[model samples]
Target: MKFYCSIHEIKKTKTVLVGVPYDGTSTYRPGSRFAPQAIREASYGIESYSPYQDKDLRDIRFYDIGDIPLSYGDKELNLKLIEAFIIKLIMKGKKTLALGGEHLITYPLIKAYAKKYKEFAIVQLDAHSDLIDSYRGESLSHATVMRRCSEIVGFENLYQLGIRSMVEEDKLLPHRDVNMGLFDLSKAEEFLKRIGDKPIYLTVDLDVLDPSIFPGTGTPEPGGITYKEILSFLKLLRQKKIIGADVVELSPHYDPTGVSSVVAASIVREILLIMGN
Candidate 1:
């Protein structure tokens, strides 16, 4: 089913939502490929109106194009296809919100963005840094997605928040700013001021929320921020120019209560409102 309140026509909206259901690079848990549909199903549980933003989905125009058709086992070809598809959407002047199969999808999405915009920044909200150079002999896996993206946009252009997990090697990488424990508004303000009016591409990995609240993620890290904290952070971005965004790493099977998917769907709603505003 389509996301809650999504329109049928893409030509009438500035915001376009698409799902990328490719998880070839998931190292630990592999069910994120099922997340796009899971989140869509969960969207029915919540209202289109967001009380936090004082906005309603019905007030905006957005189309859900469903998941992108991707073949299994061919990582390079899938990445190319994602990049090409995103380029088409960008060329049409649409602000894209992708429901990801894995965080690796962000690499291609940013690659497509790089082709159109000369300058932009990536705002990453996740439990892990995802800055490793390679994982298990593969350089393009989810573990290295941010590292790869840092190459395209430069390390100084990437702002990582709520990062509680990372290896020793990841610590050595030059990042513009990283909030290790939780989301800090002070540090976020610093990065926002530095970027000024640069367009932003936001990537949210659901694992950033505490496992007690959101346990349907592949790599669940403890000591995460609360749902209220996340909403507060998103509220901070309402005034910024968010060009595009994606919500990744939601493995619904891990949480049979279905709360995680609802959480993901709610975040998607808030993001849609932000884009619409």
Candidate 2:
């Protein structure tokens, strides 16, 4: 209730970090609920100094606000709860960052934020489009996160990155608002030529990395991008109006070496450093 990683005694900081350990839809590999804990533990290994940035995100005020406890497998209730949490944080004038459960969490997040900002948009970094009508018959499945974000959330624009895998069916989806298939930064560079600029909410799914590089997620796509490539695009996005961001779908059970958690934490740190500045 007070602060995330309670022992750190971090309170009254600008960064309000919260964990949403709700991975009920991870049919392939459950355990994203544990990602927050593992990432937090690995955060101890991270340093504020970075060759990638002139300053650390902590140079500004940042603190983990704590996690939302829910494991009942109720997607509807979970969405409502997430919406309320974010709305409350905005009411408090706190900038919130939610940790992983699954990508589905982004739908409710975008919907809730759109109620506040009429000009909201999203910068999605992932291996899949996540714009399906539904995955396995659920409206809030991880595969369909962006679809719900577009249909229900009402964002003005969306720019996706690192998309290397998708069924042909996903390519023919109804919502055309999402600017899709902008994979690595190199590919995204050519893709961004047409992407222009907008106020953005960032959502990251770690499976975007090639399994050889980081094989820790609910799903792994082999032809995905690299950390360097993903970071390049995010670094460029640092100049835009990035309202908030979430790192999703990082199932820690698969990462016994904890390499993925370190990467997730690094991404948060870098984004906050570059954009949150």
Candidate 3:
């Protein structure tokens, strides 16, 4: 299914919603591959308009290209496929709004964007630092996605927020980016303002939401930010230039109540408006 209220075809759109439906690298729980369809199915429950932004999806001409049919076993091939797809959109000068299979998908997405835009930034919202060099002897797992991304975009251009969970190794990582915890949010607007009009690839790991507000991810960290707080963060981001973005790591089955999917869909709607505007 397409996103709730997408209005344009792929070739004729400013923003394209491409779903990366491969969860091959998930270590904790393995259902995020189902997230794209789950979020799309749940989008119908919400309206196309956002009172917060006073904008409607009907005002924009973004396209939802549905999920990429990635292979199950070959993760290298899957990531390459994601890169190829994103390159096509970039070549067409279209910004991408990707629904991800897992955070690892961000690695490929950024790799593709890096080829087109130099000195662009990466803004990550997550519970974990994802700064590990590798997880389980594998460098390409979801746990090391940001590390891989930093290699492409550089740690100087990476900004992380809402990080409360991390391993001892994560803290010891010398190349960690400027990470902002819950308390640091008060200064977020200033930090984002310094970024100015730099092109940014925004990636949100839904687990950044507290388990109480969003419990459908593989790793649900406690003491996370609220949905309203996330909206505030997004609002600050509206002034910046967002070239591409992804909402990832929502394992719908984890929350049988389906509230998580609804939240994901709503965030997608808001992000789409931000990118379109």
Candidate 4:
């Protein structure tokens, strides 16, 4: 099913929603591949209107192109295929909102964005640092995705927030423009001021939220941001030049309450509202 109110025709739409349901690299949990459909299904439970932005999804003209047909075994091929699809949307001047199978999907999306925007910056919200050189002898797992993206867009251009869990080695690994460790919500203003008005590509890993509030993820970090805090941050981001965005890693079955899916859909609504403007 398509996301609620994502009824605009593809060819005539400026904003697009595409799902990449390939979770072949998830280490802790495996059901994230089903996140796209889960979020779409959960979208029906919420309204099209956003009290925070005073905007309605019904008023927006975005096309939901369904999920990217991805294969299981080949990570490189899947990434190439996803990159090609995003490139097509970019060529059409479409601002995409991708629903992911896992955080690894961000690498390919950022690859496509990097080719199009010269001054692109990545605003990543995640629980893990995702800066490892490789994981389980494979260089392209979800754990290493951000490291790969950092190489493409430069680490200085990456702004990480809401990171509360990481290995000791990850803490020592340093590069330009790298900001990790436990993030205080109060510093968001300073971080935004530092990044200024650059073309931004936002990647939100739903595990960044506390597991108590959103436990439907492969990796559940304990101390994380609240749903209201995320909304406030999105409002702050409305002033930036956001070219594209994604919400990833919501394994719906883990949370029987289905609150995680609703939160994901609501975050998508907020991001779309900001992107629409």
Candidate 5:
């Protein structure tokens, strides 16, 4: 969570972003919380020119608020800090695109966003459904983020994509109405065939991609989606309004070729292109 919110003085910029790098309760690989720093460092390697967004996008002024004050030792305080910071950003009329520490951070974040935009929806890209009640008895852990998001933000507007892994707890979570289409990447094309359209807020955990492409996430399950298919689904999004989005859970240490962060950075670029002027 080192530098997702970068502030640069470009005349046409209209967005304000932040990095929330606090992954305190992750049950598996323990380093995704450090992904924000790696993503920012990788940003220095990108060309400031855009192929989809007009070149003016590179000329936009934005702020990098670095990492927010995280309460690693106190879970309750972590929630408070995230909730307040998100609300503060939106109240300033600046659109926020967060770089995540872990998927768990999304719940508290939505609590703040929902204050002003009640109809907010999520377009999650992940392998696991993340509908657990708790992980090791930790209700707020990353494993239960979707459960929490449903509780705080309301389930009527959420749409989950790329969900293949399933926990027994998730079956009992009562998510029948979440409008989810769960499938392995082998079936990704067919899956999208049935669900043709909708508004979306993209939340991607690198684990959603096959480990061969990004092996640096906290949890890397087999049979994840392919990079080509993921982008294809994004391309299929037609006439839909995307309000805000996030790319979370990339642990750089395990990325043998530094591919994960580059993927994350490139996804951000694509969002800029798709949401173009």
Candidate 6:
């Protein structure tokens, strides 16, 4: 099913939503491949209007192009497919919003963004600093996705926020633009100033939210930013130009109440409002 408030006519909208349901590299939990449809189903439970932004989805036209077809066990081919699909959308000047199976999808999305915009910055909101050189002999895992993206778009342009977990090796990485343990508004402001007019690719891993409030992800980290706090941060980000974005890692079964999926849908609504504006 299409996301609530989405239209079927692709040519009529400036924003496009695509789902990548390939969680082949999820080392911890494997159900993220079901996230896209789950989020879509949950989207119907919320209102299209955003009281925080004073914007409504009804005012903006966007198309949800369903999930990308992926091979179950083929990581390399799937990444290539995602990259190629996104590159075509970028070339068409469509602002893309991706719904992910895992954070590893960000690597290909960033790669596609790099091909279109030479100067852009990545604003990552996650509970973990996914900067490992490699994880369990796999270089393209969700744990190492951002590391791969950093290689494509220099580390200087990558801004990571709300990171509460990381290894010793991650601590040694250069351009370590991370705010550990909490979301720092001052650091965010500084990065905004540095980004200036450059387009931003926002990647939000749902696990970034406190497990007390959101516990549907494979890796549930405690002591994360609250929902109100995250909404405030998104409101703050409204002033900047967001070229593309994604909301990843919501495994519905992990939370029997289905509240986590609704939470994800709410965040997607706000991000869509910002992108459409």
lDDT of 6 by residue, 1-277 (tens): 2364435567778788889998888888778888898899998888888999998888887878888889998899999999999999889989999998899999999999998888888999998889998899999899999899989888888888888888877766776734233443336677777788888999999898999989999899888888988898898788899999999999888999999999988999899888888
Worst 10 residues of 4 by lDDT: 1-10
Q: Where does candidate 3 clash, by residue pair?
A: none
TM-score of every candidate relative to the true structure:
0.95, 0.89, 0.94, 0.94, 0.84, 0.95
RMSD of each: 1.9, 3.2, 2.0, 1.9, 3.8, 1.9
Cα lDDT tens digits, model 2, 236-274, are: 775566667788888876878888888887777776665
Off by over 4 Å in 5: 1-13, 50-56, 59-61, 168-178, 184-200, 236-239, 275-277
Order by lDDT, highest first: 1, 6, 3, 4, 2, 5
lDDT of 5 by residue, 1-277 (tens): 1222333442234455678887787777777768878887877777656543345344445556677878767878988998898888777765667788888888877787778775656667888888877778888888888888888656655567668787755655554434566764444344344334543466777788888887888889877777777766665543456556667888888786888888777666555545443
- lDDT, residue 187, model 4: 60
lDDT of each: 0.88, 0.73, 0.85, 0.85, 0.69, 0.86
Candidate 1 local lDDT, 156-247, one digit each (tens): 88888888788877766775335233443336676777778999999999888999999999999888888988898899898899999999
Which 10 consecutive residues of model 3 have the lowest summed lDDT? 175-184
lDDT of 4 by residue, 19-100 (tens): 9998899999888999999988988888888999999876777878899999887888999999999999998899999999
Model 1 residue 93 lDDT score: 95
- Summarize candidate 3's per-residue lDDT along 105-175 as a digit string, tens digits: 99999989988997898888998888888788999989999889988887777778888877776654543
Candidate 2's error at 109, in angstroms? 0.9
Off by over 4 Å in 4: 1-8, 175-178
Evaluated against the true structure, the overall lDDT of model 5 is: 0.69
